[model samples]
Target: MLLAGCAGAPPAPAERPAAEPAPPPVAAVPGVGVEERDWLPPLFSGVEDEAHYYISRLPDRRFVTTYGGEEHPRPWYIAAERLGQIGEPAIPLLAARLESSDEYELMLALYALMLASQDPSLMAATGGDTLELGSVLDPRHNAENLALARAWWQRQGWRWE
Candidate 1:
């Protein structure tokens, strides 16, 4: 009678299968292989406001280094892509950066500016043409392109406002 009573107790609800162990939590240590979240430059630290912060980061070398860093796009490149998506709003900032940057930085600035503006003349006059080896080695044509771009911007200052 005791055995019969024990058997009737619903078979102890059958032992449940053991669940798979959860994956280890991912922890990214700062300055290790992981990129930092607060990657904004010191130049943009005192920006007028949030809008200007985004504008200021557009020209920062740390945000968008040259194409030789890694196989994957760097954090700055991704940020530049986001800035490019903002279109005309990015132009004045990019223009200012273009005026001040060096050749490699100029390449990055002009490329981002061209993407942000998508203006045909700016494209035709600057991005469309390739700088030869000598031109790349020098800033003469880059200066010319800068002047041309700035001139165009001056002509269309009304649009920028």
Candidate 2:
């Protein structure tokens, strides 16, 4: 009777076969500029503001050194992307990297340039404003705008000298 009672106890609810390793826990770290809950290294301490912080932060000489340390780049090219988000702050470093960079790194610099300027370089060229490449590198239409920057910089009222 005891064995019968135990067997009938709902067959112990069929231990729900080990679930597909529940996805990694979302980081509890508070975000500063944007909600980058995942993809960040566990050791990375960042603010979630989306504007005041994040990769958009200004880059100094240190940026050159820092950007290179992250070598396994097939993923967060965005950090290299931070190069673009940081804008002119990123230019010197980006240009330097571009000088000797692999095809992928140049792509990152180009993407960053697109991000930091000319959100719509077209609109800016038409005179409504200017493109912030840091804001638009990921778009498909940037080639035209980049050409514009190269071709028309003199007319924009600044001498290369």
Candidate 3:
């Protein structure tokens, strides 16, 4: 007896959807630096909008000031404050900042993570105090501390502590 179950026709291949067009680039003002244009809010915006402008610029590592307050803390401090204010959304960015080569950036990122998480214990686990972290130029210590902090965050699975 001949088996009639074998199919003669192969199934047609699935068609892929067409790629969508890319969105237009954000318009930057002429003569303004790219970082400035991106982070500096258009003049006359509210304070919160202005705060966001500075917050958005944190990754640049160049912008160091935002309007307001007599203290005028360093740019890194401003970035940390903003990141802390941003909370969980800032974690991955702060985590990525953990890899920064600049000492200030690395410290700021770690501090930001701590502040954003509202956990002082994280600093202790990082193997140094804020002073040591900010002052130590020893790459070895820095790398080790960074590794410890990064490992902690990794172990925590990057969730807020």
- Using lDDT as the measure, the top candidate is 3
Candidate 3 vs. truth: CA RMSD? 18.0
Model 3 poorest 10 in a row by lDDT: 129-138
Residue 11: error of model 2 in Å?
Answer: 46
lDDT value for model 1: 0.52
Please tell me which predicted candidate would have the highest TM-score against the true structure.
1
* lDDT score for candidate 3 against the true structure: 0.56
Over the stretch 1-161, how does candidate 1's per-residue lDDT look in tens digits?
Answer: 44544545555677899999999965553222234344544343322343256555644556643343667643435444544555556676766676564565565555555456664554464554322122321345576666656665666545557
Prediction-by-prediction clash tally: 1, 28, 0
Q: What's the CA RMSD of model 2 in angstroms?
A: 11.5
Candidate 2, residue 51: Cα displacement in angstroms equals: 15
Alpha carbon lDDT of residue 74, candidate 2? 29
Off by over 4 Å in 1: 1-9, 12-51, 58-60, 64-79, 101-105, 119-141
Q: Write the residue-wise lDDT of candidate 2 on 1-161 in tens digits.
A: 44444544454455666768778864464421232334344463332233233343223223332222357422334345454444444433433443332443444555554454443444354464443343333435345445544444334323112
Stretches of candidate 2 above 4 Å error? 1-76, 118-161
Model 3 clash number: 0
TM-score of 2: 0.33
What are the per-residue Cα lDDT tens digits for candidate 3 across 2-51? Answer: 87774867777898899899999877654344434554455735545544
TM-score of every candidate: 0.45, 0.33, 0.43
